[model samples]
Target: MAPLEYLRPSDEGAAIALAEADGRACLLAGGTDVVGLLKDGVLAPSRLVDINALPIAGVEIRDGGLSIGALTRLSDVADHPAVRGRFPALAHAVLAAASPQLRNMATVGGSLLQRTRCGYFRDPVTPCNKRAPGTGCSAIDGEHRLHAILGGSDRCIAVHPSDPAVALLALDAVVRTRGSRKERAIPVDDLYLLPGSTPERETLLEHGELIVAVELPATSFAARSCYLKVRERASFEFALVSAAVALDVRGGVIRTARVALGGVAPRPWRARAAEAVLRGSRMTEATIAAAASAAVRDARPREQNAFKVELVRRVLTRVLATAGAGG
Candidate 1:
C-alpha cells in the first residue's frame, strides 16, 4: 500500500474542506472496509480524512423519534436500552451481523456506505465496470452465486451488503447529510442508486457531503418487526438471503405492511409489491406465501444463483410470520 497523508479533522467543516480540495481523499469512519481496500490497491487515495470526530457520535430521542448520529458505533446502537425496547428487531439484526469487535469499531455511516462484496469489484485487475468504466462485468460470466438477482444491469450484478440498513429502510428511516449547503433529509430507500451507466456512483451523496445523522420515524410496525438472515456460517458471514418484515395486523387483517430485502438486490430492496399485497389482507399461510412470491417476481438469477429466488421467498415468508406471531 502507498503511504498517504492522514487528516484527523476536529469538525465536519474541516473534513469537508479537505475532501473538497483533494479529489483522492477518502472518508474514514470505521476502516472495516476502507482499510482492506487500501491495502489491496482497490482504493489508492492520496489523503485519508478521518471523520470520527466531526460532530457525529451521539444518539437521542427527539419529538418521539430517534436520531442516531452518523459516527455512532454499531455496538452502542445495538445495545442501547431504548433501541432494545423500542426497535428490538433492528437490535437483533445488528447483534447478528459481523462480530462483537467489529460492531465496536463499525459506525452507522460506514455500514450504510459499504461497498459490494463481489469479488470482481474488489479485484482491480478483474474486468469490472463498477471498478472502472467500460471494462465489462466479470460477474456476468464468472462465479455469481452471491451477486444480485434484482435491479441489476449488464454492466454490474453486485448485491448491497447490509443487514441492519434493510431493517431501518423498512421502518422509513431518514438520512441527514451536509455538504456545500445546509443539512437535508433523504429517505433511506432513496439513498441507494440503481446499477445503471454509472455503477461507481453508489449513493445519492454528493462528492463532499457529510452524513450527520439518520432519523427514524415512529411506526407501530416497529414493535412487531423481525429480521431473518441466512448465510454460509452461523455468524461472522454476510447474508446469502435476508428479509426484514413489519406489519400492522389488526382484526385478523394487515392494515399496513413494510418489507425490505438484502443480499438479493443491487440495493437495500423495498418490497413495495409484497407490501401492497399484504395491506388490508388476512395474515394466513397462503396469503404470506403469495406476498413472498410477489416479492421475488422480478428476480433474474445467473447460472450459479437461481436458488436465491426461492431462498429469498422463503425467508420473506418466515420473517413476516415471525413478526405477526404475537400481533
Candidate 2:
C-alpha cells in the first residue's frame, strides 16, 4: 500500500474542489470497493477525499418517488419499508449483492461505481485493457467464464458487477450528481458506458463529479418487478447472469414492460428488444419465450462464455414470468 493524503471535506463544494484540484483524488464514501482496489494495487490515488460527513445518507420519499442518498448503506436500502413495498426488485437486487457485513458498509453510490470483478483487472501482473489501456485483454482468450457475452469489444470483455444497477435500469432510475461546473441528472441507462475501444472509461461521469442521490420514479410496473440472479453459490457470490423485469399488465395483457440484464454485459443491459416484444402481448409461456429470444438476438458470445447466452435467456424468461404473474 502506498501512503496517500487523507482529506476530510466538510462540505460538498469543498469535496468537489479537492477532487477537482487533484485529478487522482478518489472520493471515499463507505470504503468498501475503493479500499480493496487500493490494497490490490489496482488504484493508487494521490488523495482520499472522505465524503461521509456530507449529509447524504438517508432514504426519503419525494414527489411520489423514492430519493436514495448516495451515501445510504446498501443494507438500509434493502430493508427500507418503502423500497420493499414500492420497488421490490431494487430491494431484492441490493439484498442479493455481496454479504450482510458488506451490505452494511457498502454505499449505494459505491455499488453503482464499483469496479468489475474480472480476475485480470484485479491482478496487476495480468494484462487487462480496463486496468491498463492499450494493453491486451487477458480474459479475451484466457479464463473468461465470468466475462461478458453481450457488450464485449475486442479490447475488453469484463462484465459490470452491480446487482442494483440492473434493477435501476429496469425502473428507469435517475442519478443526481454535483460536479465542478454544475449539477446534473443522469439516467441509469446512460450512467454506464459500454466497453468499446475505451474500456478503461467505464462510466459517463466526469472527473470530480460526485453522485449525490439516485431518484426512482413512481411507476405502476415497479411494484410488480422481480430481480433474479444466477450465481455459482447461494450467497456472497456475484451473478453469472441476472435479470430485472418489470411489467404493467392490464386485463391479462402487458401494457408496458422494462427488462434489464446484468453479469452478461459491460453495463447493465436494457433489453429494449425484449420489452418491445412483450408490449401488448399476453403473459404466456410463448410470449415469455419470444421475449427471451429477442433479448439475446444480438449476443456475441465467446467460446468460453457461450453458455451465458442461453443462461441469460433462461434468467430473463424466469424473471419476466415472475413479474408478469405478480402483475
Best by lDDT: 2
Estimate every model's Cα lDDT from 0 to 1: 0.87, 0.92
**Candidate 2 Cα misplacement greater than 4 A, ranges:** none
Cα RMSD, each candidate: 1.1, 0.8
TM-score of each: 0.98, 0.99
* lDDT (10s digit) by residue, model 2, range 147-224: 888888999999999999999999999999999799999999999988889999999898889999999999878889
Residue 81 of candidate 1: its Cα lDDT? 83
